[model samples]
Target: MQIYPAFHIDKKITDAADEALRKAQPALKRIDEVTDYNQQKMLAAFIHCGVSESHFAASTGYGYGDRGREVLDQVYAQALGAEDALVRYNFVSGTHALTVALFGVLRPGDTMLCVTGLPYDTLQSVIGLTGDGNGSLKEYGIHYRQVDLKKDGTPDYEAIEHAVQPDTKMVYIQRSRGYSLRPSLFVEDIEKIAAIAKRRAPNCIVMVDNCYGEFVQKEEPVAHGADLMAGSLIKNPGGGVAPTGGYIAGRKDLVESCSYRLTTPGTGREIGCTLGNNRELFMGAFHAPHVTGEALKTAVFTSALFEELGYAVTPRWDEPRADIIQAVLLRTREALIAFCQGIQKGSPVDSFVLPEPWGMPGYDCQVIMAAGTFTLGASVELSADAPLRAPWAVWMQGGLNFHSARLGSMLAAQSMLEKGFLG
Candidate 1:
C-alpha cells in the first residue's frame, strides 16, 4: 500500500541538468573514450562489496610495479591537478589516510588546531580527546585545539585565529559534516580559513578532510590553497572502483612526507611501492565525475521530495548544496525510527535488520544506522542515521546508485505516511 503519492519531479531541474550535460558533451565523450567498460563494471562490483581486482593482485603478490605508480600519477594529473599523488589499497579508510598525513607532517610537540571543531565521530579518538588512546596524532605528541562552529554551522574565524598558538604546525578542516547534522563548509569558507591560517601562523599547514564532499563542488581544497586533502577510497573519490584504500593529494612536499609515513620513515613514496588495485582505482577515478554528479542530483531530488511532504530539509532548493547528503528533520523519535526502517528495508544490504538507537563506540550519545553494512560510513549503499538528540533530527546520508536511492526515499516516505508522520 503506497501511503504517499508517486514522486513528482520538477521538470525544470531535470531539463536544466540535461542541458548542462549536453553542453558538456565533448568532455563527456572524451571521458567515455578514455574509460574502459570492463574495468568500470569490475570497479562497480568491487565498491558494492569489500573486494576488488586490487585485493586479488595484493593477495597473489603481483605488486603494482613502477607502471602502476606511473598510471596513478597520470590519473591524478588528469583528474585532480595534483603534481604527485599516491593511491594505495592498504589505507583502509579516510581516517587512516589522515593518520598517515598527520604523522608524516607533524612531529612531536607540534600543535594542530581543529578549525572545524571536533571532526567526524571516528576522528575524536585519533585527535586525542577520546577513546582508549590507541589513535595517532595525539599519540605522536601533537597538541590539539578546537574552534567551534557558529549558530548557522559556519566556523568562527575569530575563534580560529585566537586558537592559533606559536607552535601550531597544522590546521585541520573537515568539509563533510560527518556524524554531525551541520552543513558542510563551502570552498569560499575554506579559502577564508586558509587566509586566516596564513595570517595568524604563517608557517602552519592547512589540511582538509575531503571525504563525501569530493567532486560535489567545482573547486577542490587543493585549488583553494589547502596544503593537503585526504579522503577514503570507499567514499566519493572511489567512484565505485576502489575495493579498499584511501588517497592523499596536495603539495609535492606534503604528499612526499605522507608517502614516507605510509611506507617507512626513511622509505619515500617510491619505497614499499606495491602495485595496488590499479584497475579498480583507475576505473573508479574515471567514473567518479559522472557518478558524483548523479548522486548530487539524487540528493537534490530527495531534498525537494521530502520538503514537499512537509519535512524540514536543509539547504532548500534555492540554496547551494553543501555536500551530497540530504538531511530531513523528522522531529520525533518514532518518525525517525520509521523512516530508518523504511530505508533499511529498501537497501541492498540486509533488508531484515531493524535499526535501533544503540551506544556506538566513539560517539557521545546513542546512534542509529539504517543500512550501513560496511562497518563505517560506506557510501557504496544507501543509509540513514540520527544522533539521539532532542527534537530527534534524522540525518540521511548516501545514494550509491541513484536508482536505489530514489526507490529507497520513496519507500521511506511511504513508511512515514503509514505511521501518520505526514499530513
Candidate 2:
C-alpha cells in the first residue's frame, strides 16, 4: 500500500507520520506473534468441529436437530479454551448476549459485582443501574455495584478485596475500555482479579466481557482466570465477515445454563437454526486471526500518527494492546468534531455527509460517530466514536487493510491541522 503518495492531504504531516510508523517497526513485528497464536487456536477449533459444507444448511421448526448450530458452539468453545459455548443468532446484539449471560447465572437473591468502573452505557439499563426497567436484572431482584478504577486507570485491587461481599455471586470484569479513559484490561489483570475473587468469594463466578478484545492477545482472559467470557460476532471475533451473532464461552455448567436462557431449559443447545449463517461464522472464524492482526497494525499506525502531531493518545503506540481501540485526545470540541468529520470524509460509504455530536441512545451526553463501512456499525471495520466530554478525544479503530487505514489516519490528522487544532 502506498503510504504517502495518493491521499490529497498535507505532505509534511504525512511525511512525519510515515517516519513515526517507521519508528514503530518493533511493535509492528509483534502483530505477527499475536496473529500466529490466534491462528493456532482458530485452526484447532475448526479441526475439532470437522466443519464441512453440509453444516451451512439452515434448520427450521423449533430448530431441533441442527448439526451446524451444535458444531458452531463447539467451535467457539474450543477457540476460547472453554468447556462449552453458546453461539447464537438469537442474540441480536452484544448487550443481548451479556444480558443472557448475566440473567442465566445469577438468581433473584444474588449480587453482581462489577470490578471495573461503570460498564458501557448500553449495559446501564440492562443492569438497572439507572432506569428501573422491568426486565432488568435489578428489577428481578439481583443486586449490583461497581468499583471505579484508580487514577491510573487500573482496577482498584484494594477496593475489590473490600467489596467482595459473601453474597457477590459474580465478579464482572470488562476487558475492553468501553468508552472509558482507562486502558483495556490485559490477561494478567484478569488473572489478578480472578485470584482475588477465588480467595475472597470462593463460590463466586468470574466473567470477562471480551468485546473488542478477542484475538489481539496470545492468551484469552478465560485462559488466565475468568470462568466465563462473552463477545459479539460483529466485533473482533466476527472478523468483519459474520452478518450477525454473539458468543458465550466458559465452564460447561455455566454455558449450559446460558444456553438454557438462550433457548429454553429443556431444549438447551438442542435447538436454534444456523439458518445459512454457518458459512459466515466458519469463514469469519477462519479469517479472524489475520483480520485482527490487520486491525492491530492499523491501531499502531493511528497511535503513532496522532502522537506525532502533538496530540495525547491512549495506549500509546508502544504499549501492549489488549483490544483494537486507539484513542486520540483532540483536547477541544471543534477539533473532535473535525476529526470525526475527517473519518466520515474518508469513509467508503456516506462520505459526503457530516457527523456531529447529538443525543444518541444508550449515552447520557451527545456523541459523535463516523463510519463508512460496508457493514453497518461494525467496530471491526474502520470507525471512530467519542462522547462530548472533556479533552475531546475520539477513539478510532478497525481498518480492513493497511492502505485504507493509512489513508484514513492521515486524513484525520490533516483535518485537525487544517482546523488549526495542532501545533
Q: State the RMSD for candidate 2.
A: 1.5
Q: Quote the positional error of residue 232 for candidate 2 in Å.
A: 0.8
Give lDDT tens digits, candidate 1, residues 1-423: 122344432343334334433343453343233334423433443344344344334322423354555455545543554556677778988888988888889888888888887788878788777877775667878888888898878899889888876568899999987756677887788989998998888888999998877766655788886888888877777776667788888888888888888877565665444444567776777667566655665566566667666778875543566566768888888898889988887776686788888998878898888974443456744778888787587667666666667667766776777778866
**TM-score per candidate:** 0.82, 0.97
lDDT scores of the candidates, listed in order:
0.71, 0.86
Q: What clash pairs does model 2 have?
A: none
Error of 1 at 418 (Å): 2.2
Candidate that would win on lDDT? 2
Which residue ranges in model 2 land beyond 4 Å of their true spot?
1-6
- Listed per model in order, the count of residue pairs whose N, CA or C atoms clash below 3 Å is 2, 0
Residue-by-residue lDDT tens digits, candidate 2, 159-258: 9999998668999999899787798988999999999999998989999899988889888888898998888888888888887888998889998998
Q: Which candidate achieves the best TM-score against the true structure?
A: 2
